[model samples]
Target: MALKMARDDLTEFLAAEFPQVAQDFVIEDVAENRIRVRLATQDRHLRPGGTVSGPSMFALADVGVYLAILAMIGPKALAVTTNCSIDFMRKPAAGADLIAECRLLKLGRVLAVGEVLMMSEGGDAPVARASLTYSIPPE
Candidate 1:
């Protein structure tokens, strides 16, 4: 399906609705069945070993899929995460921005399923993979 919420629409919606975290993420690309999200890396997102923290990666995965769902379903603020599973594969480069490519596998009335693959900017291999499910609120 085509995106109801494009990059600019999603960005503005997040800015207006989730001002708290609006600056942390950027909607890099949005298209039919796909979305690319970036976590604007900062010192606070780095771990002790100078690698991107797990929590930061998780945030990217969560929001990536969340925005993807919103793209298909429009700005549904009530849709909330129901489950998530992530695997941290390789260490993320500390100085590089992290990118998440998300694809919606299913978009049903009550539930949505999607997966995200995260990698460091300019890197070839994936640093983490995540699967997420969101519960779409009733109308």
Candidate 2:
């Protein structure tokens, strides 16, 4: 399917609608059914061991899928997550940003399903993987 939003458009939309977390995520790339996002790791995102926290990784997956859906379906800020299953496979690298590669697995009128694989920057192995289902609001 054709893309409804580009990287810049998604960035602006995120800033306008979700100002609270807008600064934490960077839209790295946007394609048809995929989007890459980076979580700018900060001290607040670190755990006691100085690694990125699970909640922070989960946020990256969540935002990545949300933006991927919006890119396909236009600026539907009301598209909300209906279900999510995330696996924390390994520890994230210290002092490195987390990258989430998200892809839309299925898109229908009422729902969208997607998966996100997260890895620490410069790391080859995945740190986490997530499958999510989002409920698209009626137009």
Candidate 3:
């Protein structure tokens, strides 16, 4: 399937619909079935031990899938995450930005499913993995 929305379109949509977090993420790449996003690392994203916090990582995974869905379906602001399961496999680097590589596994009339592989800027292995399901609003 072809991408219905481009990177700049997605960015503009995010800024208009979710301005609070529009600057926290960057659209690294967007293709037919995959979308890559980067999270800007900052002190607020770190935990007590100077590691990226789980909630911060979760946000990456969530937004990754959300955008992946929109990439194919266009900017459907009402599409919402229904379920998410994330596993942190390793600690993220203290100051390195986190990257989320998300792929759409299924996109149905009412629901969409995607998986995200998250890693630190230049890490060799994945730091976290997540499976997310979203409920798409009817047209």
Candidate 4:
């Protein structure tokens, strides 16, 4: 499917609609039914054990799937997540960025579902995995 929003467009949309977190999340790439995003590592994201925090990883998965939907459906800021399930499989490397690879599994008139695999930047194994479903607001 042709992309409804490009990477730059999604970046700008995120910055405008979600200014507080815009800087931390970067739209790394966009592809058919998929999106790759990075969470720039920051001190605030650490959990004291020299590991990335759970909330931080959850945000990464949430935003990654959100943007993946927008990349295909256009920037619908009102689209809200209705369900999310995340698993923390391993400790993410401290002081390194986290990358989330999101794949949209289903998209319909009012709901979208996707999964995200998050890994430490330059690492081989995934630190977390998440499945999310979003409710697309009516037009």
Worst 10 residues of 1 by lDDT: 87-96
Q: Candidate 3 at 47: error in angstroms? A: 0.5
Candidate 2 weakest ten by summed lDDT: 53-62
Per-residue lDDT of 1-139 in model 1, one digit per residue for the tens?
Answer: 6779999999999999999888999999998878999999988889998889999899999989999999988999989999999999999886789999999998999999999999999999999999999999988
Most accurate candidate by TM-score: 2
Give the candidate order by descending lDDT: 2, 3, 4, 1
Off by over 4 Å in 3: none
The TM-score that candidate 1 achieves is 0.97
Local distance difference test values of all predictions, in order: 0.93, 0.95, 0.94, 0.93
List, residue by residue over 39-98, the lDDT tens digit for candidate 3: 998899999988899999999999999999999999899999999999899999888999
Report, for all candidates in order, the number of backbone clashes. 0, 0, 0, 0
RMSD of 1: 0.8
lDDT of 2 at 76: 90
- Which is superior by lDDT, 1 or 2? 2
Tens digit per residue, CA lDDT, model 4, 1-139? 7899999999999999999999999888999799999999899999997788999999999999999999999978899999999989999988889999999999888999999999999999999999999999988
Better structure of 2 and 4 per lDDT = 2
Model 1 stretches with alpha carbons more than 4 Å out: none
Model 1 accuracy (lDDT, Cα): 0.93
